[model samples]
Target: MATSGGVDVGAAVIDCGSFLIRGGLAGEDSPRALVPSAIGTRSGKNDVLGHSLWGLPELVDQVVDVYDPMAGLQAIPKWDVMKKVVDHVLSKHLMVSSKETPLILVEPSYMWGVNGRAAAAELVFEGMGLKSFFIARGPVMAAFSAGRSTSLVVDVGHQGAFATAVFEGYALEKSKQTSVLGGRALSDYTYQVANEKAGQNGIRARYELPSMSGATTEKESKAEGSNGVVDSTAAVSKDTAGSEEKEKPKDGSQDVEMEVKEEAVPAAPPGEVSKVKPTTVEAPPPAPGAVVPKEGVAKTFSLDSKKAFYRMQIVHDLKQSALSIREIIETPDPEANGGGPAQTATAAAVVAGSKVKREPRPTVYTLPDGTELDMGQEICERIPESLFDPRLLSDSKIPGIESARSLHRLAYEAASACDIDVRRELFGGLVLSGGCSLFPGVAERFQREVAAITPQMFKLRMVSPSLRQDRASAPWVGGSILGSLGTFQQMWMSKQEYDEHGAMGINRKCP
Candidate 1:
């Protein structure tokens, strides 16, 4: 997604999850192009309510050399944390940017309240003394990134993953878009496993802190266990005052205390009973299974220990189910058993239009609390015959698959309407742009199964964007590039035009 001018276009895109806010300036094609879309900040300043106290702040050593600070951000009230992230990017990027430009802010569809995302984008730019334009439709931006005449764009983010079809440069309004329980769900899952591992080791319960590191950072540190010295750059956390938490060795053995903590795990008062109950809630207890690599002890993330982190591995693979569930539950049909989901053209619309999805069936994972984390059929997958056309989920009784199929049915039907068009002309390339595209077999699955659920009239060929790394940003970057066209003004409504015509009128003006 290249821009038109001799004048460089500078913009920052932010993903504000409940736990973390990721801000990244558009970068050139490179290995780690998007840089994990994360930011890190101190305990008090990063959060407004100080909820961050629930989680440990990045260690001083972690901060000074942290390539991307947000990676350490714990799962907290994401919008607030995200705002801080936006402010951080504004300040940090502004120091090096030209204020003479408009900073385009691409936001998630569910940002703040209704219409709040656009306003937030406006405010972010205005506060920075830069004119602002909002790119709220992530799927549309991704479609723009596709730059093809016709294609499908699937965007999987940390918090959500969705799919959209683009035809003639615009998203297909009626296409089925899915919102799978995303990275946050994965974090929650990992948190559970870490806790379970801890409890299994007889470490009594305490509050668990939200934790994750973009593999870019944590993976390197995990690998460096081969080195003689502990990577001093790893983030540090403080345990409760009483517990004398020992270092977890890589070989699953406790050889010695290689690292030192300033604060000892405090012990309870003499004969005082511990309030931290082993049985409390379905969620995992903090640090339950977390292997705190002692500063000096060599370490490796154990395979058994790594299952908690399954969310990241499957983010790209199983996210369609999540989105499908969000779509169905959000459908407008009053008779649906559940409370209706958010109402938008996206009605699970990842791209141009919207979709209908049943409430996701709970994905049941054995949680520490003698309970199972119910992620639903939408979230859990077991080598389905067709990832696109899942039989178990499509039960007419179960709203999750029923409704998801409903969305696909609608999109496929519409696609059938365009049967006369050649797929070679329609989807010259299948563009897979999203965090989930990072998953293995996504392309194969789509080609094999997506058509099964659709009408048989059309032949499908798959195409995807070349830039797979910073996929979350690919669509926005692509749209930004197209928007650079001199003729684009013909389709754009001026602020004055929008003001003159009310919302209805503005809708008429939209490109």
Candidate 2:
């Protein structure tokens, strides 16, 4: 956690996720800071301060297991790390007086089990010395962020994606479900596409660089080199210094030609030579998959040139691919629906029929060492479509359970499991909230898919956070809003109550 220069006595809210942890003072509209949800072990690197480091860019390239505090359906898997994470969030990021102020912890709906809830309570009140606390589900927080009491929250996170139905601030547990696919899966797919392309083009295949920064086009670097930016002073220096210069041509026709002859200076005695100024030329950029050192410490780091393409272009393609594949799956086919000999054939045809509509969008990315990588329409638009269409997945050997669920199916199942009376309300209150939901067309596409399954008579109203950037941290915003309210004060489990009832009291107090 990185501390900002401010202190607030009010309760602080933390929205924890697999990829990022968003937190701030309770009364703020949005979180004060967002950090990667990873903790780094003690290493010799300057980036890893003391025993652990959180959300620093240098730690990403470090040789340590980046520990994710939350995994699978369980929240706060590593108890010690979770304690440190909470302490860091409250004391550093939020800059709050933990022992004096209250705390609001946001978590996934699936993690509301008795054990996880009690452990979180113990960690907050007992472990971190926080005085008061309240545990809120991510979906419920998302609903509150949207200013709605009832909603079906779809969170596309790093570990997995979930669709949870919340009615009047309470989660409908039966209908809450998650799939294996999420932001991490998409990043993996991007890596796969880049590696495959590299192999096909005979380039050394490697993972995409997570970050890089300098030339925007491939031609620009070549042009700079050809224009004599490299060693341009050599020719002029030959004439100026005590060295040989070329003779002028006879056909110059009144042109002044100055040609200097070479002169060797006498060698100096032992240790008598003066050191010439060191050249300040920039070193050539390393190749796509090569290690280079910084600060001349001899500790080198590998660079993956493919990162620019993945971050700028491949991610957008993934969003487009998800939208396209989802539309195909949800669109019903009459022949595939019927039971006949041709039914199987029709279903196969329909599954294979849909194609990604490609538009010409060229992208140019600059590498940190001033090199550029150019991507064409095909390369820029290509992503693993199989995530949404399992048939498109090349590996048939994968177990059915592991590679099965699609986005459309997950949404349908969640909506179907809701009570019949409020099923319409659930459909209409569908809220897309998460890092992945920040993709341009995801919300519109999600609304369209839900509208397809819903009857025309009931209005299908889907909404997202008002600010585009807030979509990723919607739950944090909700926690901030909820914790600030005067009515919410009664919900916090104070230190006095925790002392009397112990950690188990959280299940009853928060409930």
Candidate 3:
């Protein structure tokens, strides 16, 4: 509800990612709604909307096709379905008429040539019948959120990661780089690890259905938790101890995989695994007359597409709650006495050996059904480590896993691709944004890793917001600040302008 020129500037900011869509009024500190960028549909029925599309027990009961419209921050494939999602957010969540409210939409920097910007402009100006609209790139807005007009913005989002060089509020088109190592990739890796451990330790995973009598209201479901989905840890439990054998899916389609195409990058030498003995959590011995589940019991259940989607959500929760970047500190080699060249080689080996001995403490995470997953330090640490070393994913079947570069490499390459005059500024002002970057120690680790490859003359600094919400919704917050400024009123592309020059005209006005 900000005002410009004494007129109410009721502009709304919508920043959509592969996993979530953040929306709110201008001038707000945080987003008012964070809906899933997905929709559910059944033949001859109304489309299921918002959090309900997550296949929550109280929201959806039957099998349905859950389509994610914004996957990998790419161009919209199903414009018809995407239109419904936008309409729902405006009318249901924001509670404003599309015709009256001006809009600022945030897109990825690489989306321009693919007609993503033009299509979005069409959707807002023609499809939604909005009075005014503007399109902003994700990395540029992320820089603005950190109070920097020029910075190297590394956005680690749900589907993919991007490093873009922004100079004076303009993103360098050639300097933008992308990778498949992101939140979803980490979640998939976590899921794979959990499945392997479940097979070995008699653990099980199943969907816990809510009771009809205790179902939450629609309004309650919408506000149940952040990111639209209800809290998975607090979900109802119906699983019990029982004997069952492991069952594998017939088609292997149940395995979680990223939607992007696969590409290959040269693999790095594998690191040595730690030899430290780790403790494992075991279930208590069954009481008299109690049935004890046998070891290696999978208790596999048939999951429809909808249920598979929900299972992925559970894995995502585990990644967010349990996974963290393992801080790697280089230690001086003790064997490096003033000696022959062979001694220096031996010293380097000793340093590498020391890294294998530092293991993180194990953490136990309880599932919705009260099943405890005792994640060993190696697994907990390695999951986030994959972001920094894509070679860790070399064993997995995910497409493009072999081709993905570590985040630091991506940042260095992007900045190097920029003009020589601005490379120093880009390196000095590195901004971390996106939900995946919220992992503890990410900022410190990124800055340290990037500095190792950077020129000695340039000083590097990491700009990360202290609040978790601020980093996760950085792009939306930036748009909110820009939309509410009185001096920025003339920047909006009005309806008349769209009619005069068509959707492509938005590129000139917004840029």
Candidate 4:
């Protein structure tokens, strides 16, 4: 709760992006509910929506079709789904009635031209029946979060990146620049590398099974001895082991060896030949909503759409935990041989020369099947390099990747688009905000790259927050600050104003 004019404001702030929707009360240090910006609908039933499918168990047992309402920071396409999401957050997470709370909605700069602000106003005032609300641009909020009224805010989020120049807390919309490179693109590249490695090493997908009475303890066990009960040893093995013989069950179901702790069996009586053997049973069908297993034999298995989606989640975690950017870009020495290109050097030597220094040890990520992946520096550094050089993504299948400019170029161009008097200030107050910008060494690298292209007379400075969480949710933090200010209490657009002027009134009121 926050106070304005000695009264409890009870304002709510929602910052919804392509990947996540962050919602919380105003004046809070961080968002209370950070859920995925997606809703799941069962196949053939698009009207029925599931709010939080991030939990694995909920996703199992049904073929869910995941849809993202905010895919590219544009105007939301699925207003119905968006409304449900808002309700879920407000009532379920924030425990506040929509009609009682004043809301601040954050939107991107590009959406301002497309009537996105007015549509959002309609959703808040008419759809949700909120009393009052304000629409704030994401870049301006990010600048505010960084404690600057004037800054060049570069936000690299899940779907795309944008560089906006702000002056006195107002975004210079004409000077805004956008790029296709973002956190999801880098995560996709990391997934490619990890998938290839898993294929080569015969790694499988593992999942934690729900606990049942009389279940075995937390130890590696064989799935065969579960006696028709689904246990923690269930695993989905990939078809990586070439030429391995696989047993086919008579029921036409795949037989996968479950990795679970072996149950103790009574010793056979009087040394008679014990006929007990590992029971072979029908494996769980490789279908949508099938539970992932803990371990399995080295055999081929089809990856259902659900499994692929889940694996992407694992890759996303690995990217966040293990990825790092190089402080300095590595390039081959041009004057190695008599001030000429090293044409006589071998290809391996040239590649070695261009390689950035590796970390002392590779990051080890364990898969669900207990296989450790050695995510070396080469993979970690190369994925983020695409942000600096769009050419690195020329071969990638990601749409619009080739059309994107590097982050440095984006910032420089955005500042150059502004007036000459403000260009220096924008350069001096560069701010990095968003999940992608939280990468270690990203700010330093951005500053270096911008300085290389910037004019000699200009001075460049980065005003990024020291805390990672602050940087990732900078816009939401800014909105939280603005909503709690006593001075800002008069700024919200009331329901009466909306009724008189219509949805388009938000532009005049919020802007």
Worst 10 residues of 4 by lDDT: 248-257
Q: List the candidates' TM-scores in order.
A: 0.49, 0.65, 0.74, 0.72
Q: Candidate 3's residue-wise lDDT over 1-511, tens digit each?
A: 4343355657988886666777778888777665566655544444555544443344454335455554443445345556776675665556667788888888754454536577777887878788889888888888889888899999888767889999999888789898877766776677777756655432332433343223445533443354333332233222411111101000000011111100111111111111210011001111112232222221111224354455665566566556777755545555423222112111232122223444444467665556688888777878788888888778875557878998889999999998778988887788888777877667657766676566655667767566766887888888888888898788989999989988888888877
Instruction: Report the poorest 10 consecutive residues by lDDT, candidate 3.
Output: 245-254
Best by TM-score: 3
lDDT of 4 by residue, 1-511 (tens): 4343345657889886666677878888777765555554444322222221432232233334444465443434355557776776665456667888888888754554546677788888878898898988899999888888999999998757899999988988888898878866676666666777866543333323223122222211332234422233232123411212212110000121111111122222111221321111011122234333322111112335345444556666676667777755434444433322222212122212232555533478777666788888776777777778888767765557768899999998999999999987888788888777866668766766676577655667778776776887889988998887889999989999999999999999887
Sort the predicted structures by TM-score, highest score first: 3, 4, 2, 1
> Model 2: which ten-residue window has the lowest total lDDT?
249-258
lDDT of 2 by residue, 1-511 (tens): 1123443357778876656566678778766555444443324422221111211122223324233445443344455565655565555445556676777888864454777788888877767787788988888899888988898788776656788888888887888777655655555444444334434442221122334222123322232234222111232223333431212100000011111111122111111111221101001122334343332122222233222212322333333333222223223466433322112212332222353445433354332223444433444333323434445544322223265565556766787897778877776676787756654445655554454444444455666675656777788888988987989888888889989998999988876
For model 1, how does the per-residue alpha-carbon lDDT over 417-451 read when each residue is reduced to its tens digit?
Answer: 44446333443344555444444344444433344
TM-score preference between candidates 1 and 2, better one: 2
lDDT of 4 at 319: 67
The TM-score measured for candidate 3 stands at 0.74
Give candidate 1's whole-model lDDT: 0.35
Kindly provide the TM-score of model 2 when superposed on the true structure, using C-alpha atoms: 0.65
Root-mean-square deviation of Cα positions for candidate 3 versus the true structure, in angstroms: 13.1
Clashes of each: 57, 0, 3, 11
Shift of residue 85 alpha carbon in model 3, Å: 2.1
